[model samples]
Target: MNAGFDVAVVGSGIVGLGAALAAHRRGLRVVVIERGSEASGASVRNFGHLCFTPQAGLARDFALTSRELWLGLALDAGVWLRESGTLVAARRDDEFAVLRDLAATRGVEVELLTAAEAEARMPLAPGTAVGGAFLPRDLQANPRQAVAALAAHLEREGVEFRRRTTVGAVRPGRVETSRGPIDVGRVIVAVNHDIDLLYPEVAERHGIVRCSLDMMRVAAELRMPLAAPLLTGWSLVRYGAFSATPAAAALRERLHSERPDLAALDLNQMYTRLPDGTLIVGDTHSRGATVAPFQAEFAFESMLDETRVLFGVDALRVVERWQGVYASGPDDFLIEEVEPGVHLASATTGIGMTTGLGLAEHVVAAFSDDVTTTADEPGFASAPTTTLQKGAS
Candidate 1:
C-alpha cells in the first residue's frame, strides 16, 4: 500500500504530533506513522511537569511556548490540565543562596519563601528548611491521557494516522515503511531514541545514546491539598536553570558529603500529586547505549526516605514502578536535515513534554521555508499519490 500526503511524520509521539499539527495548521496534509498502536514511549512515561522555570537560556523560551501550546491543546481536546506550579525548597544554606539568586532575577517569577511560608503553603516540616522558591509558571497534566488526547484531536482535525507501522527507510519526499511507501512534500522524523533505526549514521555521528530513568508512583495515606509539584535541594542541583548558577557547585558538594548514596544514584527527589491523589515521584538517572532491565530497591527507598524527610510524612504506599528512556546528546535538542526533504527533530533530553511542541513548530517552519526555496532544485518532487492499507497491531 502507498499513502500520499503533503507531510509525513515518522513518529506519533508528542514531538511528531506537534510537527503534524503545525504543518496541518499551515494547510499541509499530514499523516503520522507510529510503530505502536498508541504512544507508549517517553511521551507518556514522564512526570508531565511543565517546569519552565528550570529551563535556562533558549530552552526557557521554548518551555514558555510549549506551556501555551499545551493549554490550548488540552482545552480543545477536553483533556484535564492541572495548572499546578512548582515549589523548590532549599534544604541547605548553599541551596538557599541559589534560590535567593533566582528570586533576585528581574524577569524570573520566583518568590523566595521562608521556612514558615513554605510550610504554610504545603505540608512541609517546620524549622527544618532554610529557604524555598515558588515558580507559578510551571504546569502539570495527566501524562497517560495528554498524549493520547492530542493524537485523537489531531485525528479529528483530519490528520491521517498509520498506527502499528514501522518506517524502514526515509528518502527525499518518500518514506519506505514496513507496510509500504508514503509520498510527501516533506518528512519529519521525531522518533527520539529510535532515530538510529532510520538514520544510524546520523545518530552515530552525533554520539546519541539513551538515558534511562527509574520512577515510582505512590499512594499517599493523607490527601493533602498540594497545589503544585514539589522540589528539594536535589532538584536545584539537577535542573539546569538552578544548577547552572554559581551556587550549585556548593550544594552539590554538600549533598555528596552528607548523602553520598544519593549522589551515586544520581537521584533528583521531586514529587507531583496527580488528580487521583497518587503522587508521581522519581527518579534516578543512568545513561548508556542500552539500559539494564532492573530497578534498584535502594533507589526507591532513597526517594521515599527523602520525601518523608521533606514533608514529615511516612504513609506513602508504592503503587507502580517503571523506567523511561530518551534520546540524549551534547545539547538539549537535535534538529537537522539528515536527508534531503527529511528533517530530524528530537528533544534529546528528558524534558520533551516541556519543549517538544515548540521544537516541532521550529522544524516545520524551517522545513517549509527550505522546501519552498528548493522546489525547483534537483531531487525534489512536488506531487504524490497512494492508497492505504491498515496494519495489524
Candidate 2:
C-alpha cells in the first residue's frame, strides 16, 4: 500500500466511519486505522436504533439531516435498514403530556396514543402501560451488518481501511500508528472514548468523559414477539436526553430525591426487538472510570425482572449479553477543530447512532480551508472534568 494519504481517520467506530466516508465523498484519499481486528466499541453496541427523538432542539436538526444521510448511504451501499418505529410507553400522565409537546416539536414526528391504541398495534405490550408516544419515522438496523456493509462500500470507493492498527500519537498532517507512521494532509480523531488518551488534556479542553452501561439480548418467547424498539417510563429516566427534558426535570428531581432504587440505582430500561424474534433488553448506567464486575446472575435476573414488569412477553429466554461505553458531554455535543487538520469530536451522548452521519459530515465541512482556521470558535463550550450534569452513568 502507499505510505501516505490525503487524510487519516483514527478509530473505525461509526463516528470514524462517518468522517472517513464524508471525506472520501469529498474526493480526499483516506485511510482508517482501528485498534481491534474489526470495529468495536460503541459502534456495534446498544440497540442500533437510529434515535429520532430530539435532544432539546440540537438533536432535532441533526437527527433529521442524519436520517436523510443514513437512508442515502444505505441505498447506495445496499444495506438493510429496518423501518422499525420507536414506541415510548408513558407510565404517568405527565409523561403523556411530554409526548404531546414532542408531537408539536419540530424534526420529530411523534404521535400520542391511548393505552388501547398502543396495545392494538402490539397486543403483547404490557397491560400496565397507560399510554405511549410513537416516533413513526424512527428506524433500526443490525449494527455489525451495517458497519461491515459500510466498510465494504468504502472499499468499493477505493477507501483504505487499516484494521488491527492502533494509533499512538496524532499530529498535524500525520498520524503514528502501531503499524508505522502515515503521512497525510489532514487528520480526524474519531476514536470515541480514547479521545482523552490521544489528547491527554482532552478532558480539560474537550470535556471528554466516559459512561459505562450493561446491555443484553434475549431470545424470543415462542410465537409472540415485540413490534419495535420500546422504552417504558423507566427508560425516560435512564437516558439523560429524555430525563433532561422539561417534564423529565421534575421526574428527575423526584427520582433523585425521593426514590431509593432510582436515586441509588440509576436504573433505566430499553427493550428493542431483533429480526430473530429475540428482544434486546438493556441497560443501566453508572458513571466512572472503572465498572464493577459483570454480575452475570444479577444482570440476568435484573433485566428479566424489569422486562417482566415492563413487557408482557412471557417465557422469554436469555440469548446474548454484552457491555458498551461512549463519550458524552454537558452541552449537546463537542464539535470543534481543536487544532489545524486535527478535528476533535465525540458523541458522549447516545446521539452517536442517532446523529452520527450528519455530525461526521459536519466534520468533513470543517476540513475545508475556510472552517479549518486556527482560532477557536466562540460560544462552543469545552467539556469540563466537572460538569453541571454530574457526569452520565
User: Which stretches of candidate 2 lie above 4 Å from their native place?
Assistant: 123-126, 222-224, 238-245, 253-259, 369-393
Lowest lDDT block of 10, candidate 2 = 378-387
Q: Model 2 RMSD to the real structure?
A: 6.0
Error of 2 at 75 (Å): 1.5
TM-score of each: 0.91, 0.87
**Model 1, span 1-393: residue lDDT tens:** 465799999898889988987787767999999999999999998888889888875566567767777777766776568888898877778888988877776678898898778767776766667777889888988889898898898899899999999888889989888888888888999999998777888888888898888898988764356778888888887667887777888888988999898998888788888888888888888888887898888888888888787777878889999998889876777778877878998988778998888778767767564323233322212211111111110
Which residue pairs of candidate 1 clash? none
Cα lDDT of all candidates, in order? 0.80, 0.69
lDDT of 2 by residue, 1-393 (tens): 547788888888787888887777667889988888888788888688887663444554556656766776667776668787888877667667566655765555677889888666553445765788787788887787888888888889899988888888988878888888899988888887777777767665655577776788887553345677787666666453465556766665655665565444456677777767777777766666444556446655777776775555566677777777777556556665667778876676766887677667677765554323122322111111121223231
Model 2: how far residue 196 lies from native, Å: 1.9
Model 1 stretches astray by more than 4 angstroms: 369-393
